[model samples]
Target: MTDAPLGRSAAFKVLTTGYVGSTGPGVAATVSYLTDAGRHLIFDPGMVASPEAILAPLAALGLGPEDVTDVVLSHHHPDNTMNVGLFPRALVHDHKVEYRGDQWKNRDAEGYELTPSLRLIRTPGHSPEDITLLAGTPTGVVAFAGDLWWHSAGPADDPVAPDRDQLRASRERVLAAATLIVPGHGAPFTPDATTPR
Candidate 1:
């Protein structure tokens, strides 16, 4: 298979950077936007300081919530799914189904392609249902991996991961394929030797 799978590359940008503190209540979810094959997508549009944390950046790019075509949740955690209602017109995708309006279509996310440049792969670890969105941009492949690394530094060990072995395997899969990673919380960064395994 090709690196991008089958179509023109998409463009992506981070809307907001997320944070998780080791010893306080401070936390938020990173959000991102992507446009590809005529589709406007938002990944992990989760908890933020406010809705504007996501909306304002999207608005700056000339889009409103209604303009979003899809929203992909990496898992079921509220911190990674709370703002889904903001995009009323967008289809919502999770590991096992796609939902829009009241219609729910069952489909396995593994190898599923929403666009030539965008596809989904099952990467359960952080959560049993976690999946990753791999977007092929002009520069390289970018993986929107929720809670997998937590950030570039990685917690090294997820405090709540049910399957550490599975998590490690999933991380290997992503690291071998992606040039940059848009973690669940924090700015995107290129993977390197220092990246937690």
Candidate 2:
């Protein structure tokens, strides 16, 4: 994927890089820009996109791998987690249910959060451990929907979800919580963009 914009949140401008065929599927990746004055967060660095393809966007924003302070994966899928090693110095956040060791679950007892600005919505549909990242942007809330729903799917479905009910609830919550979403497999789009008029 190319470096598409995902709007800005506070001192950072978020961007994305499309799948580069580094793996079987081309899952879109997310990158963020932040100086020491801002929190540098990278969500879903992508699986198939080449290292250069993924990092170049950040480079364009004057951010190096080490500059990233946080790496949050929506799930354990290689598409979202494989490239994490690229940011060795970053603190990784994820639902522990998806990994074996040294992982973290919902920051709260309810498996979700809406504190301050960054909200981690525990959306267990595509995977039981998936969590969507919602950041308060200047435009509005931007959701980093990691496999919450494939971009190709219509408003009514998330075909890969193991639990249909959970996926439905998750979608509803995301639709309500975010104005824009950077999906795991497709381009960034607005919830209203996919809604039926």
State the displacement of the C-alpha of residue 51, model 1, in Å, after optimal TM-score superposition. Answer: 0.3
For lDDT, the strongest prediction is: 1
User: Candidates' TM-scores?
Assistant: 0.97, 0.76
> Candidate 2: deviation at residue 22, Å?
17
lDDT of 1 by residue, 1-197 (tens): 43344554888989999999988588899999989988999999889989999999999999998999999999999999999999988999999999999899999999999998898999988999999999887888899999898898898999879999999989988888898999998989999998988
Error of 2 at 38 (Å): 2.1
Q: Please report the TM-score between candidate 1 and the true structure.
A: 0.97
Q: In candidate 2, which residue pairs get closer than 3 Å at backbone N, Cα or C atoms, i.e. clash?
A: 1-18, 1-19
CA RMSD, predictions in order: 1.2, 6.3
Model 2 residue 50 distance off true place after TM-score fit, in angstroms: 1.1
